[model samples]
Target: MITVVVFFSGSGIGTSTQMQHNNQASSSARERHPNSQIPLPQSNYAKHESGATRDSRRRKLKKQKVRPEKRKAGNLEYTNERNIAAHVSRGNKDRPIHKFKNSFVCYSNNARTKAVAVVKFYPFEGMDPERKAHYEQLSTNLIAHTRFQNAKKSNENTLGGTMYSLGWRKGFEEKSHLGITGIASKVAKDQEGWIKLFTETPWINDFLAQRFQDISLGMYREVKEQYDQQKAPSLTPFYMADPESFCGHLSFTFDNFYNKAHKDEDASPFRFAMWIPINKQTGKLVEENLQVEGGEFVFPEDGCAIDFSGFNGVVECVWKASEHPHHTLPSSTAIGSSDDRLGLSCLLPDSAERAIERMMAVEDGEKLDWTIQDLGHLHNDSLKYDSKGKPFETNDGVDLQASPPSACVLDEDSSTEPDKSLSSQLKVATPTQLHRST
Candidate 1:
């Protein structure tokens, strides 16, 4: 018996003259919070909504008409060499930055895959100054609320920082505890501030939708197909549901950060992961400054890097992170100097694909009436099934291939006692959660 469980709600760039001061401010903010365990910033983003209100928000988001600009494919800047083998580094210190003379889109020389693309584009080029500032302030607060625990080091110990994963991720039975389809990563407060940030930040969403229009539309279609809008109303995505989100996961890296070459698991090679660098001081977007140095996006595997050191406006790197071994040179306020820098990347995780596979396996005629909390009894391994109708085994050593009749089985004695695990107790609204109309 597959016990049905509840579904949960799920839940930019800028200018110049405005650019210089913004970076300075961001650096200052990082200085103030340097490793301090301050409380999460208050709820200045959005108010908690009832289910009815959430429905209203969804209708509004659908009707909004935001379109992305059409960039010419002719502007692409092609590189010379193709790297077929994996990149080998000798003590992270030997990596060099590739400095380009002009701003252009980078494409690896490989005729076969064309796996990486680094474009020099400014996300907030034409936006209003005040509005851009508002976005920055909110971002700064979000950064301040975050406390880095372990320094996520790449290349052994060459580059590292306090990393925070904010959006939806694959459900782990022992970790997330909910064996259901997908779950949101935890934030500072009971997700109050985080939810507000997701809902209130429409400008950011619109920018992402516009910048990666094709990917956004593709993800929207995939989501709709997996969870029918009418049948799985509880699974409605957050913000303005339309194409506000292109990917299911977001990762933020705060001050003292650089990446050693690495590949993301379950990443989509066909879809690009969007990377936006921010000034750690103001939480504003990272503007290009000839005087500022470092922060070159390097792909050791490809023997190339996109140097953001001297660009005119802002820079955004859209690359196939799942297919490439990439890293970044430490960014600073000036050449050979150190300062706070923040980075964010957006991608759809493989776990989500697994979750969707499980969800689609359910009989179409059945109504998904379960709540998010009820998913605790489901096992992640049982969530995915082989084409032969056998459940796959997860790393947790759950013998799911034994052909158990029900995926969710409570041990004989605990059915009445009620297991009080953390997964079964969560109740919060996220961007992914949508309301069902009464």
Candidate 2:
């Protein structure tokens, strides 16, 4: 199948090598020699049970004829890296819907562009604790943001604009180059670092290569040539040698499971090129949120939807976005669901380089706003104002300096809240501007 996507499901193993090893072990154990009894892993639900007690429980379930999908994929317990396999699918699995861009012959399970297909990664066993914790905390932050704990209070009631965007450049206007102008990063460096999260992800990069290898090999080779000239001598193919020629962009949409159904106008030069970044653990969180609310991904054209509500498998999805006209279902979960429903868009180095060039060449590189335009390499749209009627800046906007502050998107790990006045806040809609939304 034309599955050029690797989702970080349950455990987020380091590489394919680890995946093969785990799968092989599972296969070997399943090769039961006609009579020998095999034991399932200890489940969290019965962690306190003695061996005999667990064995008795399994016997009971077996006698009851329990199916694999009704519970975990394996006999593993309810750990964070629980290998439930929680597999889900939709549409006709049989038959190819025509070869996608035909670099090689393959069919995409998610190939139904009009009706976007959502599938998750094959589950693996055991995950690193640190990584698991990282995902949990991120989810916590997302929920907190939604609850207003992380929100900077705002009183602006004017028309910001019609287009909404995420990610911003430091010391620059909020609405330039893939920007939602008034929304600045609480910490400057976070902008760049967020972009790297997807570009450097092992599976993400590998899958990107696998899915588009033939069509993109020539383009990758061209960059690899110049990457060879770097002085630091990093061995990775997608190394960040320089922002202009290297670097990437990661823009995202954060909301609950419910929203208006509209075509994702992301087919713009930089958007159709982006991909989703989700590892196993993060995928689990997304699925759980889906269960609470916002039950499915809907295709507006035919009003067809794949019910994703209630842990119905929210996992890694990859597509040639430009080729798809799609929209997603609003989340069902709301309270304490800051990190619940998320859609991320990423720009790898090749795309970023081209975007940066276009950004620099804007207005013959003369727009004073273009000084920090490189930030758009990741976010791609550096327009001071989206083509709509409103301006990006408000009379009371934060007073930024001519030169960007030394702190930037990459340095967000130790982010200290910038002055509350400069922090980004959800724009409060006034009675008059209620017609426009951010």
Candidate 3:
């Protein structure tokens, strides 16, 4: 019987054979060990590669392949500097959207001392036909003004400070060199005119200051009258609803240069007063009077007052109202000063009430009580006064003559009565006590 022997070797057998070979080799190597033994042969199939060595070899190869002509000097340095600057400047570019182009300079003393310098750059997008036509006319007019051209030559301080001119091809060259174009020319011209007007004209500055003062005063008077009419006892709680609006009076007063000491003892070089309106909803002062030209709105040791200068040369006044009296300490919570009385007055009683009602109803209304007071007082103070130091009164109770002595005092012990003619029929008492019983 020819029976073929069937033999099946499992995968484990192959592993066993490999293990046996490894063990035999290790044993032989151990047996051959000596004081100075030869190292075992390394397997060519078991090569060890290091990342550092591989990278070095790659770099060497790359360098060898690149031509010397292709290399640039300082290129790497420039790239590094550029990258660092870009990283540093990234935050600046992401600044708040409301950032002002001009720096605002605020002054507590004089409006003329305040200035704003704004820089604006313009480039051409698509031009409007009307704008282009306007520019063309403007350019023509500029050229027609020979005096302007002569002024440019004679006065080095004139428009010559700018780069563009209507002269030669060299003018165009300068334009191109500075990257200026038609649009840039137009912008420069407009800006130059504005700068000149702002910097060179005193009357212009005064006019602007006067206008701002007037507007501020008008707003303050209206607000004060509204508060008075409401007859609210105090304005100490409404600061949160609109802190900005409530503080508008303070800002206006400060800006107009109203001195607070004027209302203290009538000793200030300038006369002033302040009329603050309290918000009914929040019970905090809403707004103050704007400083007028002749009289000044001032805060007394107590309530507020607008002291006039000899009746009406220029009305200067400031008005401020807060939830708490600004000049007083927390421990001393009394209202009214030694000089001025506190209480709502008829002069502007309904002013505050009307304003509050309108504000609640979300309507816009305005009154000019402060202006009337300013002008009327000035007119009445101009009337003649009697020997008793009382201003001569008319049948209509309006003073038609200027006070005999402009330096007449309105103190308490003085039997001198205010010329009734000069006083407004409407008088609003403050909420606080009068500093002196008049």
Candidate 4:
């Protein structure tokens, strides 16, 4: 059994150390009193409890037995860190299935003080069925309202694609990388339903933040501080499910989503991904009543995968994405155009804080309309410029100075309504195009 190691509170006492000490003490006592019978120590509450009360407590413990399906060893495979590292180095190619029985915290072997990853089951612990159904329905609705772009480059066997992202993004000034800044990723004009869903449902952000804090305290503190700093007064476009989410960005994907093995080397350590299966017919959680077989989140490096079919509610996997190379296996049962699984990921890029700071510091009127081409890192010396600060034709014969802005840029004293026009101008490229470009 791959048992989870539970950490105990207090300064120097470890669970294993305490158990070993107790065992040793018991052995020593038995040696000294070979013929004597030693009475076992009892808890104060147990000693004072009535017979009926004790009987009731015993019955309750007995009723909470582990279910047989959860006990199936077919779902779990365990491997050590060394093996995992080796697999990653070789370019992860194999898919391993595992049953997710319990939530566990993975600490660094070299530095036990650092918690590198966490896997949580039933993240929506206290949510009643009705509430779970509501979230499931919202997820389905989001899928309907938004358009998914193909992730062609790293998709598994072309059975992939169907991915999209939302939140703050970094880009440079028009025709120049000198003024790199952050902005909110916008959806298409027709996708107003998706925008309204997030604006109207503020609790969704609260739920994400609360649950994020619940699993990892240290990570939550750092992320919360970053978000608070980003909320400072600014004209920088802020479009997200929740501006306060520890996740500066979110990506949603659907329709038999499966990706080739890869690592998000640029992502921050504070990252989490979720999978919620919805029934196509009823738009409700599949749960145990229905099954969406396969679509396991596989960690080739770890030699294991999280099979969601065994999960009754949403499962959130938080890990060091920069270090882990993972992919997914296609769903055997829920395949084709009717794929019902909805996937979500909360990500913070390693450069997110710096980008947000740059975006916030920019004064209202100086910001320019940046196209997707300006987002890449470019050297200032690479472009030819005259003494008057005017750009010349590049080596490729492309005139940077002649490039047109994606939207209309009006003067400060223009007759048009500034607020409405500025807001409309801010919606540069739709998320579908932006995601594909990224």
Highest lDDT, which number?
4
Candidate 3 per-residue lDDT over residues 135-196, each given as its tens digit = 33322322232212222232122211111222111012311211101222222233333223
Give per-model TM-scores: 0.48, 0.35, 0.15, 0.53
- Give the residue spans of candidate 3 off by over 4 A: 1-94, 97-377, 381-418, 421-424, 427-438
lDDT of each: 0.44, 0.32, 0.26, 0.50
Q: For each candidate, how many residue pairs have backbone atoms clashing (under 3 Å)?
A: 24, 38, 75, 3
Candidate No. with top TM-score: 4
Model 2 CA deviation exceeding 4 Å by range: 1-118, 121-131, 137-247, 257-291, 300-306, 312-314, 334-339, 347-355, 359-369, 373-438
The TM-score between candidate 2 and the true structure equals: 0.35
Higher TM-score: candidate 1 or 3?
Answer: 1
Candidate order by lDDT, highest to lowest? 4, 1, 2, 3
| Runs off by more than 4 Å, candidate 4 | 1-99, 123-127, 148-161, 170-195, 229-243, 280-282, 334-339, 350-438
Order of models, best TM-score first: 4, 1, 2, 3
Q: Candidate 4 on 200-263: residue-level lDDT in tens? A: 2334555666666655556667656655545421112233213445655566776667777877
Give the Å error, residue 304, model 4: 4.1
In model 2, what is the error at residue 329, expressed in angstroms?
A: 1.9
**Candidate 1, which ten residues in sequence have the lowest lDDT sum?**
67-76
In candidate 1, what are the lDDT values of residues 143-230, reduced to their tens digit?
Answer: 6535311233332624555676544444444423112122222221123343344343344444544545433333334433433432
